[model samples]
Target: YEVNQNSGNENENGNGNRNDEATIHKSGNRRTLHTTRGCTNKEFLNCQPLNLKGTEGAVGLAHWFEKMEFVIHFSNCVVECQVMYATYTLLGDELTWWNSHVRTVGHEIAYEMTWKSLMKMMTEASCSRSKIKKLEIELWNLTVKARPKMLQKAMELANSLMDQKVRAYVARQADNKRRMDNNPKDNYVHPGRDNILTVTLSRKEQRKLLRVEPWT
Candidate 1:
């Protein structure tokens, strides 16, 4: 009877040991998962994007938007979180406008808004027609200033091409002269045997030759 009881006690102890090992494994996995979450949270905070104020003109707004998008992409934020993080960085007039917008739209709809829609609303509210016109005029002036350089480069390319064509024409003429020098009998096919044509025909004579005169 004592031997039987001892064997049963050993079986219970073995089962408890296995349960403890499984519990420890589950806890370790949970800790690792939590640590990973904490690390990502730190990363998101470290990579926070630039802020915006409503008073910043078109150029400043454009710069902020570019930086913001870069940070958002690096941070790997989802659509809903993107709006929250972007609006969190707003200051001064921009914050005031955001609050007004939220009050008008209500909390549920405002919080659910996409990042793109928020940007569009902000642009419409912030960038006035005068600022847009100013930006356009500046861009046009830059284009105008760049025109002379572009034209000069184009002219240089065209001149280089013309020079190449001229060089090719001169080389062909030289080759013809060399061939004539090598084969002197080729010139005997001229109008008369006594008339030794010294050089190529002029453009005027060539044109005249092309024109068929009526028989007198």
Candidate 2:
């Protein structure tokens, strides 16, 4: 009976040791598993989450980050290259970078990021338009102090949004030209009138003209 008890005790200890080993192995695997190659400093800054509102917002941002990580990991070569280009645009100087690199990967992503950043900066200003203007002036002053050339490009982007009238006018002109180009030929009339005009009408026009009755 004592021998049987000892065997049972040894069996229990063996099982416990196996379980511990398994646990350690599982933890090691988790630690070693990385979703993607590490992000660069600029990429990290570009992909950083905004200040979220609540737990729900935080979760949403976490999910977005995970999705971005997955893309970085498993996306095709083209998509990965695009993600890199988008990262550069968000954190780097657009004009200088644009001049340096001809390929714009994920252009839509860069556009959306640029717009969102500008909107956030605009919203942080005081409520009044005058206050917002003053804030922009102060921002420009600080930017110029740091690096004048960089600030010039930044100001150009800001001013592009500020000059809405020019954009509106250019859009209207383009729209008008497009409409004229697309106008249907079937809707228009021939220039000269059949009866009232001094020039003689063609046979087809004369026949149609004859069919019309004068007012009694």
Candidate 3:
């Protein structure tokens, strides 16, 4: 009977040891899971996008553009790349990036207009050669972040817009020069001005343009 009691005690001890091993294993897994969650949270903070509120008003759109300058310069998310492409389409569709206030009752209305005003301003202000150089450095750092696949695409979009703005600016400058040369003595000013920047209609147009996937 003493031997039988000893054998039972040994088996009970073995079972208790197994349970303890399992508990430790579970705790280790929990720690690993917690560590993973912490890393993911950091990624979220690093890659999170800013919400742009100014679509119609120049002040609002200006703020939105300011947010984008930081975001695009440092963001590597595929979705964020699409955000810039989305902006291009937004400016293209309206052909007028500024608010109606830009076309005050005093200014002469023209037959056809385009997005040069606002596009030129943004490209000149934030996308200047100096700023572009700084952005290039930031973009390189961003490419090493998560979702690296879209980094090149984001750069492409920005470059394309900059190219477009440059072409438009040159054309406008030439036109201005031609006008001045034609009437050196008139001291004439053009009836309607160019270069306004504003976006309206919320993000609906941007979403629709991106949906078309014109860049693809």
Candidate with best TM-score: 1
Model 1 lDDT tens row, 1-216: 122222244223434531111111134324211111112444656886677876668788888888878877888665657777778889998898889889998988997988788778877877664476689999999999999999999999999999999999999999999999999798666466334443334544765888855458
Which 10 residues in a row give candidate 2 its minimum summed lDDT?
Answer: 17-26
| Model 2: CA > 4 A from native | 1-56, 78-81, 84-216
Q: Tens digit of lDDT per residue, candidate 3, span 33-137?
A: 111111222343465544432334445456655655554445432332333332432342133532342365323332122233444554454334346567887
What residue pairs clash in candidate 1, if any at all? none
lDDT of 1: 0.70
What lDDT is reached at residue 59 by model 1?
A: 82
User: Considering TM-score, where higher is better, how would the candidates rank from best to worst?
Assistant: 1, 3, 2
Query: By how many angstroms RMSD does model 3 differ from the true structure?
Result: 35.8
Give Cα-based local distance difference scores for all models. 0.70, 0.45, 0.45
Off by over 4 Å in 1: 1-42, 128-216
